[model samples]
Target: MPSSIFINQLYRPPSSSSPETLPSPNTGVRAFHQSLPGYKPSPLVSVPAIAARQGIRWCLVKDETERLGLPAFKILGASWATYRALGERLGLRENGDVVSLQRLAEAAKAEGVVLFAATDGNHGRAVARMAGYLGVGARIYVPSLLDEEAISKIRGEGAEVVVYDGDYDQTVLATKVAAENHAEGKGVLISDTALTVDDETANWIVEGYQTMFDEMEEQVLEITGTRTITHVVTPVGVGSLTQAVVTHFQRTPRSPKPMVIAVEPKSAACLKASLEAGEMTSVKTEYTICTGMCCGTLSAIGWPMLKSGISAAVAVEDSDVDTATKNLQSCGINAGPCGAASLAALESLSSGEELALGPQSVVVLLCTEGRRGYEMRSNSQPEP
Candidate 1:
């Protein structure tokens, strides 16, 4: 790491080789991406044996914690979305970081093309990264309340910034409105949430997440020599990545289904509540330690898939997020609050008791980010 670098949270996911069998015709789109914006991070990470000793069985952490040098699982969704969107407009792919609007402009085959989005953090960074690689210019709108440190990082990526004087949700709404206005008044708008749900781009973005699962699958085999994954714990906001996990496992030809547990900050557990209600629903939405999970509305595409497919949905409090982070730290892993939401949920599921797993069971926690949440820590000490 550079001596000048500081710490914080960001989002992303990764890789499995193409299956020998063909991709199902109606399943999520499979893309062979190289040097793309998102990552194909290593999935089979070694955590301390505490989880295994607890009889948690084949517990594994699919660590995207180190992805793109950011600490969250959002990059896969955002970067894939950006790549395809650019392909749609420029016929050229963006294979760079979010901070290069100038680079994107240089790659533009069509005249006067740009990209736009509203995000809490990682999503904006990803959009900016893609725009940097593919467009003439890119702009991002964020909530007035986002951490400035995060904003600085995004700006460093060469994006023009619009700060909405409201919460993150407000930033999302305002950005969408701005993009709509820009499209109507000028020429076009590129929406991120559509990638969070259904649309060819979103679907492809979700498929990119399959790589994350692919790596985990290999890790599980290497660690336990068992292909059986009994449970998978994940964090959700609008449920894009959550759906990605579920969709991947569902399409996978295993006999028994892995329990898909969707964890979120209680205040922003839109998908959890929607699954309970058996339909897509919205909540008031609020701030939480897990900023990445603070979504008020459900992604229409994700809601139905999760409601039908998920084994359980859990809403965790901020304290649990802190605890999950501490636990990951003890294991020498750095994960953001959103990244550790899965471990937090699993901790609650076990009632804080040592897990009791039989030989046949293997539990996996997707540690979705690394050091990115250091910004939210009480002390912004340099990472260990």
Candidate 2:
């Protein structure tokens, strides 16, 4: 069969300015998260073997496997967005006195507002975890097609789980309708991807992800003694995390903005299709092993940032993900299909002259998740 991979360059403006030059909500989001209990920066690890194989001087992986006691990095965004939205509902200012999750929970309970969201796996679990921490109720909508392992994990967080019979995009719509018809007026929809709906909370979700970049920036400088990040390869699911990475590097003062390449499952390469069409577009998607990146639509809140900041987009096949995951394991890193997809992109780019990675290039791959009952096997040889 022909390779199911696709690549496209985005149209960037001539005089584009970084969002960091302006005041951002991420500053407050970062501070809020830092104050939480058990909050610590995730590790930025250097994989010498992978670097050597790719012919790059440095290959750093920001391991988010253990973030906020979750197997994925979704909590960073879920926690911040939940806190900010809850604070707003309680009439708290942006810079209001720092409050505990318990206090926030009490206020939420009194107001009878329950946190709500639709997630593939990690994001819902993250939201449910936050709801448990804050002592509030959460109603999570998940696709019926989700693996039992992930569904069980979300339920373990004390959230009322509703599995809709459809795909992720359909589940998102169902969750939105449930929130709209919530008679108690307590459901707060915190979706990661936005369609034709109110996207304020979606924007907060994107803002919340900025904490990852903040931590990565500090960690990179601490480890390398130089803030030189030449390239960033991350999985694109509705473009939220990708937007966060792009905006952070673009906006941060005096920081070298790394070229961002987004990786997606070929079956669900919505962002790649969007870029090629020069507009927000959706694609007909089939199930892929990379469940977290199986989004068929782009987030309205994230599209603009990605359009302006991303250097390129690449879509790969399941075999590529399997190879990438096994290779990462050989390097002593545990990554799920979605997390390891970035390395697969790197492998593709390194093989040809597309990316031109060299000895001086320092690349960062965002390993967005840890293995969660997913089998990791090396079924194919690495591409040259």
**Best of the candidates, TM-score:** 2
Per-residue error for 283 in candidate 1, Å, reads: 0.9
Query: Against the true structure, candidate 1 has what lDDT?
Result: 0.63
**Model 2 over residues 273-326: C-alpha lDDT tens digits?**
888778889887676778788788989877877776777788887888888888
lDDT per residue for candidate 1 within 265-318, as digits (tens), equals: 777777766655566778876567677677787665666566666666778777
Worst 10 residues of 1 by lDDT: 4-13
Candidate 1 Cα outliers beyond 4 Å, as residue runs: 1-32, 37-40, 52-54, 91-110, 183-192, 195-198, 351-359, 373-384
Count of backbone clashes, every candidate in sequence: 32, 1
What 10-residue stretch in candidate 2 is worst by lDDT?
375-384
Q: Estimate each model's TM-score.
A: 0.79, 0.91
lDDT of each: 0.63, 0.81
